[model samples]
Target: MRLQDKVAIVTGAGSGMGRSIALRYAKEGAKLVVADLNLAAAQTVVDEIRDAGGEAIAIEVDVSDRVRAQSMVDAAAHAFGKLDVLVNSAGVGNIIPFLDTTEEDWDFVFDINCKGVLWCSQAAARRMIEQGRGGKIINLASQAGRRGEALVLAYCASKACVISMTQSMALALAPYQINVNAIAPGVVDTPFWDRVDAQFATLLGLERGEPKRRAVAAIPLGRIEQPEDVTGAAVFLASSDSDYMTQQTLNVDGGNWPG
Candidate 1:
C-alpha cells in the first residue's frame, strides 16, 4: 500500500501500459481517475478496479485539448479532493520514412504524445501547487527516444521531447517539492506494438511479426518486455519512494539502449 490514500490520474488508462499502471495504483490503495480518449474503455478499467474493491472513476479526455485537459484535472480534484500523481501515458505513433512523413502524421503523433503531455502536466501541476503538498508526474518515454529510427521519425522525436520535457518540468516544479520523472521502455508486447509491427511489416517487406522478433532478439535480456515490466518503476516514481528523485529517465528497456 505504498500509495495509500493518494489520488492519481492515469491518461490512456484504457489500454496497454496506462491501463496496467492504473490497475496497479488502485491495488496499492490509490483512488484513481482512469482518463482516456475512449470513455468506454476507461469505464471498463474502472469497473475492474471497483470489482477488486478499489476506488476509481473514469473520464474521457483529449489531452491535447487544453480545455479538456484542464477539465480533466478539475474532474479529478472534484472527485477525490486533490491531485497527488499524474501519469501522462496517452500517445500515438506511425511508421513512415523520413521523407514520407507528412505534417499531418507529425501533428497526429505530437498532438497526443507531446502537446498532450504538456497540457495535462500543466493542469496537474497547477492543481498540485494549489494543494501545497507536492506531487508526482511520470511520463512514458521510449527507447526510441534515445535514438533515431528510419521508419519512426515523428514518434522518436516526440518521445525525445518527452524526456527533455521531463527534465525541464522537474526543474520548474522543484520549488514546490514536486518530482517529475520518466520511464523509457523498450519493445513491450502491447496492442500498440501490434500496430507498430503491422506498419513495419508493410514498410520493410517482412512478415507480420518479423520486426518485433528482431527487436526481442536484440534485447540482452532475451525477452520482449511487458506492460507489467514497467509497473514497478511507475509505482516508484508515483510514490514516496522517489521523493528525492527528479529530472531522471529510468530505462526499463532490458539493456536495449545504453542510456
Candidate 2:
C-alpha cells in the first residue's frame, strides 16, 4: 500500500470525483477524513470505506467557509494525529454565457472553486508545517481553465485561478517540503452532465440531452471519462512516486484541450 498509515483529507467527498478519490486513498491504506457539504453523503462514503475494511470518518463541511475548513483540518489531526495529504475536490460549474453571467454567479463559482481551495490549503499547510514533514496538496482544476469556455466563463476563470494557486503554493511551501499541484480533468461522466443537459436545454430552447450528446461527440476520446480514470493519476501524485513533482497541472482529459 503506497499510502499505508497515512492521513488524508478529501473535500467534496460526498460524490463524483471527490468520493472516488477518497475511496482510492482508503484502499491504499490511508485513514481518510471525508468532508462534504452534505453530512449524509459524507456518511455514506464513510460507510463504504468501513465496509471495505478501511478506516475513515465523514464530516459535514462547506469548504468555502474558512472556519469550517479549518475545523476539518483540526478534526483530521485529532483523529489521525497528523495530516499528510489534502485534496481540494469541491467545486461548482456554471454554463451561462459571459454577458449574462451575473456578479452573483461569478462570486459563487469563485468562492466554492477558488476560495475553497485557498481555505483548505491554508488549514492543511498549517498542520503540515507544524509536523515538520513534507505534505501533498492536490487541487482539482479543469480543461476549461486551459482553454476558456465561453458559456462557462466564471467556472473557467475559477479553475484557472486554481492552477495558478498551485504554482504559487508549491513555490512558497517548497522549503517546508510541502508539494502543491493540480489536476485538470476534462469531461467526466457524472450527474454533473445531467444537470448541465437540463440547464442547457432550457437555456437554448432545445430538446433535453441534445447539448450533452453533442459535447460527447466533440471529445476525441468518443466517450466521457469515468471517475475511476482520475484515481490512478491522483494515487501517483499523493504517493512517494511524485516526490519531485510540484507546481504542475497534470491533465487527465482523454486528449481533450491538448496543448
Candidate 3:
C-alpha cells in the first residue's frame, strides 16, 4: 500500500495506460478519480475499482477546457478530502506524413496532448499548494518525443512538448514540494495503437499489423509492450518512492530510445 490514503486523479482512465494506472492506484490504497472524455467509459473503470473493494469515482472532463479542468479538481476534493496525485494521461495522435499534416491535425493532437496536460496540471498543482501537502504529477510522454518520425510529426512534437513541460513544471512547482515527472513509453499494445496501426497500414501500403510488428521487432525487450508494463512506473511516480525526483522523463521504452 505505497499510496495508502492518497487521492489520485488519472485522466483518460477509461482505457489503455490511464485505466491501468487508476486500477493499480486503487489497489495500492489510493482513492481514485477515474476521469475521461467519455463518461461511460470512466464509469466502467470506476465500477471495476469498486468491485475490487477499492474507493473510486468517475469524472467526465475535457482536460483542454480550463473550466472543466478546474471543476475536475474541485470534484476530486469534494469527493475525497484532498488531492495527492494527478496522472495526465489523456492524449491523441494521428499518422500523417509531415508534408500532409494540417493545422487541424496539429491542433487536435496538441489540444489534448499538450494543452490538456497543462490545464489539468495547473488545476491539480493549485489544489495541492492550497492543501500545503506536497503532491505528485506524473505525465505521459513517449519515445516518439525523443525522436522525430516520418509519419508522426504532430504527435511527436506534442509529446516532446510534454517532456519539456514536465521539466518546466517540476521547476515551477518545486517550491511547493510538488514533484512533476513524466514517463516515455514505447509501442504498447493498446487501442490507441490499433488506430495507429490502421493508419500506418493505409499510408504505407503494408499489412494491417505490419507497422506494429516492425515496431515490436525493434524493441530490445523482444516483445511488444502492454498497458501493464507501464503501470509500475506510474505507481512509483505517484507514490512517496519518487519524493526526491522531479523533472525527469523516464524511458520506459525497452531500450527503444537512448537518452
lDDT of each: 0.96, 0.92, 0.96
Taking all chains together, each candidate's TM-score versus the true structure is 0.99, 0.98, 0.99
Model 1 lDDT per residue over 167-252, tens place = 99999999999999999999998999999999999999999999999989999999999998999999999999899999999999
Each prediction's total of clashing residue pairs, residues at least 3 apart in sequence or on different chains, is: 0, 0, 0
Of 2 and 3, which scores higher on lDDT? 3
As for model 1, its CA RMSD to the true structure in angstroms is: 0.6
Candidate 1: misplaced stretches above 4 Å?
Answer: none
Check candidate 2 and list the clashing pairs: none
Please give the lDDT score for candidate 1: 0.96
For every candidate in turn, the CA RMSD to the true structure comes to: 0.6, 0.9, 0.6
Q: Which portions of model 2 miss their true places by more than 4 Å?
A: none
For residue 41, give model 1's deviation from the true position in Å.
0.7
Location of the lowest summed lDDT over 10 successive residues in candidate 2: 189-198
Residue 155 error, candidate 1, Å: 0.4
**In angstroms, how far off is 253's CA in candidate 1?**
1.0
Candidate number with the higher TM-score (1 or 2): 1
